[model samples]
Target chain A: MEKIKIEICVGTTCFVMGASSIQALEFEIPEDLIGKIEVTESRCMEFCKDHKDGHHKGPFVKINGEVMADATYDKVLDKVRAIIKKKEEN
Target chain B: MKEELFIEIGSAYTNKAGQDICGDTIHFKKIEDEMRTITVLSDGLGSGVKANILANMTSHMALKFVESNMDLLRSSEVMMDALPICQIRKISYSTFTIVDSNINGKTKIIEMDNPPFVFIRNQKEQVIKNRTLTSPKWSERSLHISQITTLLDDRIIFFSDGITQAGIGTKKYPLGWRREGCKKFTLSLIKKHPNISAHDLANEIIEEAKRKEPNNISGDDMSCAVVYFRKPRKLLLLSGPPYDMNKDKEYAEMVSLYQGKTAICGGTTANIIERELCLDCEIDKTSFDKKIPCASIMEGVDLVTEGILTLTEVYRLLKHNIELKNDNAATRLTKLLINSDNIDFVIGTQINNAHQDPNLPVELEIRRNIIKKIVRILKENYLKEITIKYI
Candidate 1:
């Protein structure tokens, strides 16, 4: 199975805004997407706290290093689905 | 340290005044991490407020001394010398009964100025041989102190003088309720409800003591504490649908490996389990109420019920002890939980959007919140080991 690496920032700022939900992605994955995704929590994505431009804020998820800003439930879901769908098509 | 123990303490005291305060004090503390349990019940010298204070002080000191690994009899001696003596009776102000038990089934009971403790094994009173030790302060004052290795299903009941002294001047019995009477009543009750929980049994005995009272006015403060040794009955509860259908096999395997009773909650989750395990579920047509859905039965599953509503009802019944018949799945589930010693909840993370339907009369709650609330209540009130694992 081809795996899509999913990175989630679990730093203090990100966690307060709801990044812990990202860690539960393993339980939230759909049937077709279960084993095909490799989820990891990065201490800091350098997007939430230290980003100078500030386009990407806290509670962020990065699929293969592509940052998703304000990674709410729907936002994270969309990013994960995109990666999993791409792998399925391949 | 891992052995299961059930401790129940109940008290009934009649005050000279109509106030609710009973002079007798019952205190129980369990250091689960340390595998030690201390139960102290003290009856003060007189019936009212002064007696209450003395009882409280004795029990408080008794627990502290026992926790520090002081010898039981020696500790009693210290307590006797420390407390103020009664001018007329020439004895300690408060009389106490202490039951200190360790995880290895070693139980030490020390009683000073109270009645002898009763040991019941298999519905019959077991005669316990205790050594009479004299108080250091007063050589004439001797008390009963016993040590025993508790066997599984053994029950030790200790009470204040008020219990055996019930109905002293009544026509029913010119003499008070004696040790023999107490034993007979306890044996009869145990015979009728053999598997009664500790809380229920303690309550029954205390209520009986009150019944034996003349005109419901107890002569003294009454308290009863019981310790029952039994195997832990574990229950596994599965609720909600798995987020990934592919993980159903893993979930089913986990359920199959559990050593205790299995309960499947939610229609979708049950169907998923049934599909993965290739089991058949026969739905019960009988409805307990309209609020909750009908129950179903799978071959190996102990309980099967509809999702959120049944769970909500179970949570409500546990939180607020309402009267409900056990004919339906929800109430039966409640009964099973109350009787069990340990419970593990395997919850699925998939949100049921349908539960949030606008037409529903009750407020919609997510499964995680419901599970958390139920776990808290079961742990705090029922004293059960509850663990939650997400799928």
Candidate 2:
């Protein structure tokens, strides 16, 4: 199966909003999902600039082509597992 | 009419071995509005605090008088009469050399009781004629004055007696390294690195002078100052994202079209450039400092760093004139600012909400404030020409 791509935004807003913790996903990937996921860093995806109302939101991550906002370590990990499981079933 | 050359002045000094402060003083002022520069180097009669005060007073008075349009010869005379005499020695003594130059034209050098300034042109020492001026008030003293039109790549190097007299009473040189020795050494340096900066060249000469002393400790306060006429070095610094997202492409275009070295100081700013210019930004994981975030690499950008944090660190470094040691983002940025003669800043007005949190450290000041502080220091302290544009 083709690997799922993960691009984490390491831009200033995202990094300060806890993207650094999500970056650790590279080292802590579950054994089942290790080889199936390819992780990379985006200097910024500019997702934070597209805010709802007037509030700026960040710490974004993209699974394949889908972007997840306000991302955390567990949220990113669970998303990666779900993507990998779906790819297997398909 | 001759085109104006960027005049780069660099100076270095070492204290008498046991003293914490250098007694030799070097001061320079660039009158930007007038397109001129005045540099003064003074060495006091003795070593330590008293000498420091004497040298400091002489250089300050000399610089101020010249800046006010006083005649260079008259200024030297006034400075001489103003200094107090050392009672035991029965001499009011301090040596000074002043180099006053018009950026687009000729340079006038005045020397009194210090080693004659060394003039280098085309990688060779060029001889210039000097007229001796003596004031009847101090008939015992004479000033050597020279006026010459300087070309690109010409360098004027002057130093205190300590530099010329290093290693006195030693077997290597019973008579010490005189003006001839200093001149010969400077010529050798220019031959080796024809493009060496005024700062590095002056530093190298001081280091060599120190080595001539016993145990590599200078016996007296030593100093060397160099003035080089050359082309200006340019740098562009981009930080923050544009307030209007639509302007991102224009901002990125500015980076692409700039002719000199470029640095991006914020992540979102880098992202805008990466996207609009179709360039890749890579994280540089090899070096890290606990205080500063790690730097990133990009196709055309010379440096990439986290915005507020790295800029705050840079402001502190420039404000205090701190010496950089680590290979982190802040030091790299500081070094770039120091080496460049002209700096242009493009700052985005976008507000980062994450930085507005009161819980954040106090050092994380607003981006505009930090850049303003950096600009003031670069202009006033480092004598750099700077321009800023807000997007």
Write down the TM-score for model 1. Answer: 0.64
> In model 2, which residue pairs have backbone atoms overlapping below 3 Å?
none
| lDDT of the structure predicted as candidate 2 | 0.85
Q: Can you write out model 2's per-residue Cα lDDT over B1-391, one digit (the tens) per residue?
A: 6654788898999999889888899999989889889999999989888888889999999889878978766877888888888878887889999999888768989888999899999988888999998888888889898998988989999999999999999999888888899898989988988988898899999999999999998999999999999888889999998999999999999988998999999888887888899998887765455455568899888888878878888888988978887788889999999888889999999887666756533435788998999999888878888999999
In DockQ terms, which candidate is top? 2
* Share of native C-alpha contacts between chains A and B (below 8 angstroms) recovered by candidate 2: 0.38
The iRMS of model 2 comes to: 3.2
Candidate 2 second chain TM: 0.96
What pairs collide in candidate 1? B266-B307
lDDT of 1 at B276: 86
Tell me the spans in candidate 1 whose CA falls farther than 4 Å from its real position.
Answer: A1-90, B1-25, B44-61, B70-94, B132-143, B188-196, B214-222, B253-258, B277-300, B306-331, B354-365
Instruction: Indicate the docking level reached by candidate 1.
Output: incorrect
Q: State residue B99's C-alpha deviation in candidate 2, in Å.
A: 0.9
- CA-lDDT, candidates in order: 0.74, 0.85
